[model samples]
Target chain A: MREFQLIEKIFKPLTKGCDAAQCLADDAAKISLKKNEELVISKDVMVENVHFLSDDGGFKIASKLLRVNLSDLAASGATPLYYMLGFSKTKDCDEKFLREFARGLKSVQDEFDLCLIGGDTVRSQEKFFSVTIFGKVKKWQILSRNQAKEGDLIFVSGTIGDAFIGFTKACESMKYFSQRHFFPTPRIELGKQLLAKKLSKCAIDISDGLLADLRHICHASKLDAEVFLTKIPFSIHAQKILKQVQDGGRVCSHPELVSGSKFTTLDLLSHGDDYELIFAVNPKNRKKILHLAKSLKLDLTCIGEFKKSTQKKFEVVLRNEKNQKIKIKKFGYEHF
Target chain B: MREFQLIEKIFKPLTKGCDAAQCLADDAAKISLKKNEELVISKDVMVENVHFLSDDGGFKIASKLLRVNLSDLAASGATPLYYMLGFSKTKDCDEKFLREFARGLKSVQDEFDLCLIGGDTVRSQEKFFSVTIFGKVKKWQILSRNQAKEGDLIFVSGTIGDAFIGFTKACESMKYFSQRHFFPTPRIELGKQLLAKKLSKCAIDISDGLLADLRHICHASKLDAEVFLTKIPFSIHAQKILKQVQDGGRVCSHPELVSGSKFTTLDLLSHGDDYELIFAVNPKNRKKILHLAKSLKLDLTCIGEFKKSTQKKFEVVLRNEKNQKIKIKKFGYEHF
Candidate 1:
């Protein structure tokens, strides 16, 4: 199919019920903001092999691309509204691939109540996708990373390290962790509730792993973070894998997955792709925050707290079960 | 440099003077709109060796990327505001290349009163760039392709096919047409004046050649366009090349540049990359539009008129200097 037909047949339906899109027929899309509302925008780019595996299907890639950007809005306590997708298709992207990709986008849009606005598509040797998502929040309720107070308690939603485990397992053709790796929950409702109740003012999504992302908050707020390794929440599967690796049990034949190698708990904390949110809350709202998480059926763990930075530099201190500080060599993934 | 350091040292400065950008430190950018103001957004993706040459400098590529998207806003009669860039860098994009790219972005942002909001940068094999530009237009002043009326005089800004000539010549290491191809002047002021003075209500940018883009207006408006070949404006350089080629004189040693080859006036009309605005003006407002163009020191020519479609399908009829009908086998470029 040609470019115009591909858009009309595969992507145009994603803009249904969105008057601002103009059926993707105009030179630009028009968006009107209501009074007292502010628009929040974020963009994320994913390249084949670098961000996602080359063997992954188009559906998984498309869904992950949108969800990652949505996670950013969730971090900012914003409601998903609209998104524009920039797709560079490789030679392997046939009509079937585009249809599946559109299906994935449709599913996410339906779930999040978001609309596709406008974007550009081109042919390229490398397949990559960039999604710029728009969301809305109250004018004064924007949640930022620099708003964390020195005494604020650090909270993380849902269990961590599942995505990292999934990534490693997916490389071995293991479907055990594929769902967690391919599909991520953006936590939009949690973000909205946190803003509506004025529970938190600082938050960030764990895209570059927990340690690296929390360091961002520390740097922006000019504070230090004290995280308890034992307090960090992990799913049952992650716990099993941790125990097996610690006991020198062979989990897989992959070089990185060898018994007691780099797949330790510390390494998991440094690996990314988890879409859960890490937020800062006042100590006074500790009980209320837990109750809020319970009501939403999500596990909210208090694994750390913010402290005044002595050297005026961002620092994250990880403590073991015995209260001994642990040394970390690498924080997380770096694109450059 | 790591991703965070690269962003802080290189891309962060581009967000200066824009409070909504939050110094590019936040997860997402915030934008607040005034009453009766609508946001106009357009995204364009350019891939190396496809939309641009592989040997093109980072500065030229970056500037062209911004200018093309700005041209879309100009076509919609919107004022430039902010933009988000997605840069996928190849292995060869060293620090020098990044600095040059940032410098280009700074130049365009300063000239157009635009700000860098937020975006993502990643590693890729094929260097590509996606720019999503945001503009603002009064709620009811947006010019649309579907709003053209029958008998409306089709107007084009500046000269056409100069960029096409530049593209062909640049391939042969000729710098004569480089400026026109690399640095296109988006008609932002002309668009604003057209909207402010209500000179036209239908317009589109000439990126996909004059005939192809005109066909877009015709298709969207459900009308047919009749363009006069003699009325189309051409630059002196383009005119000279056309005469040389038509008179059976060799213009260059390149195969395509040989006398009586594909480098004809009609071929120029079929090639793209010209960032000029094409609008439809009411016959009564013709004199006013001419005056507005003169005030802006821009060339505006009446090339054709929109008419009711005879077969209910989009159609564009071309006429030569001798008033003979011309046949077009192809419209313009298509990605797929």
Candidate 2:
């Protein structure tokens, strides 16, 4: 079957009750919004061997791709309503891969209550997955990184460095950490709570590690940031590994960084694929933000603080226990 | 520079004054719709070697990708607004290529007054371009192929078979046809006119050739159609090449079928890449549609009529000058 036929057979069924999808028969889909609602849009692309392992199953790849886009939506405190998928596959791709991909999408549809409205499937020399997610938020209620205010306390949802650690330990063991790297849980409800309740002024999703994404917020907001080494949140597994490295040994840590105090914290903060929310809240709202995090049963940490940029250079400073600035050779994940 | 930094340097400038874009710095962009407007969404993907030549200029590739998605929006009678782009390039792609690509996008932005809100740029093994465009239309004004009636007159905007003919003669010296294949003008205003004035009941953009896209319309509407071969519109250049083939010799035609009267019309109808609009209109509203077409300075042709499907098998029949059914060896472009 051709690409359109395959879409009709395998993908159209996923749009059952979504009137906006038009049963995936039209050239485009129509979505109507309420008077006070605005659309939150984002697009993400993943390539084989770059975003995921070449041998990864189709289901995992598909789910991860969609979830990453959802994570972006979650950052904006938008409820995802619809999405368009662009699947470009190599010539050797078979029907089984497509079926499993569709199955993966169905799982996301059930989990998020969002449906695919429109998309394209094309043949390429490489396998690629791109998704453009449509989300809805009340007018003027959307969160943005550029809205961060000076003196605002920087907060992050969930543990940091888990995904990076998982990626490091993939070959050895640490299946849980590895799975965290493979599948990320987007903080949708927490983001909505923060935005809807006006608890936070700015937000960003941590895909390029903590330091890099924090710098993004600082850059956009025309401020600088100072992250406390002791305040960075870590899961029990990540903490245990870090403790091991601190005790005169390093295993499954970054290969290039030398083992010890100089490299440990910065390494954890620079490696990416975390898929967690990082937001800025006023110091007065810290207690309420903590309460919301507790009600949601999620680990929230005040990792850093935004400061005025004297030189107009957006920067992130990592401070050791002595409150002295640590020199950083690199900032974060470099896409080039 | 890293990918995000490159984005900041190159792309952020393109989003000037588009408040919803957030300067392309945020993880997601926010857009608000008017009280009576609905969002029309479409996506299209293009890959090197499959969709275009590997050596094609970045400007052409970028413009083509955006235009095809715009064509989808046009078919739905939506005014183009914001778009998100996903660009995946191989390792060899450099700054110059990206600059040209951005210039190409600037052309479209200038033409349509649309802006890029958010997107992703990734490194892949092959060049891939995917765009998801969000358009606006009045509530309940979206057009679909499923609304065609049995007695509706089938009208097509512009000429047919030009792109296919262009593709066939690309190796030879047919610059006009070749350019037509590279760039297709989306009937944005004409589509809006048809939808707003209620001049047509159902519509589709002819991307996969006349016969194939017509099949899509017929299948959706539960009807069949009879297209008069003599009535199919053709450009002056397309007619010249076809005439050369009809003069007892076949040149630059498809290799699968033996040339002559049997294969000529079927081949032209089935091969795709023509980005014209094919719509169905009531016989009572034909005069108004024609007048609108004249006012718009567009060539609109009544090439066929939809018929009730006897056995629920949606089909298209091609008739010769004598009105005899012409057998077709193949349908349209099938991307398996």
Which candidate's TM-score is highest? 1
Q: Can you tell me which runs of candidate 1 are displaced by over 4 Å?
A: A170-176, A251-262, B170-176, B248-262
TM-score of the B chain in each candidate versus the native B chain: 0.95, 0.93
Residues A1-336, candidate 2, lDDT per residue (tens digit)? Answer: 567668878788878668988888897988888998988889999987788765677888888888899999999999989988887767667788878888888898889989988888887767888998989999889888889898999998999888877666522466878778878898888889998789986899988878888998988899999888889888888888777767745565434334332336567788878889999999999899889988999988998899999988889998988999989877778766
Q: What is every candidate's C-alpha DockQ against the true complex, given to 2 decimals?
A: 0.86, 0.81
Candidate 2 Cα misplacement greater than 4 A, ranges: A1-5, A170-172, A245-263, B170-172, B248-250, B253-263
Predicted structure with the largest DockQ when compared to the true one? 1
lDDT (tens digit, per residue) of candidate 1 on B204-278: 998888999999999999999999999999988788778877776634433334533446788778777888898
Chain A TM-scores, per candidate, are 0.95, 0.93
What's the distance in Å from true for residue A111, model 2?
A: 1.9
Backbone clashes in each candidate structure, one number apiece?
0, 0
Q: Report every candidate's CA lDDT.
A: 0.87, 0.83
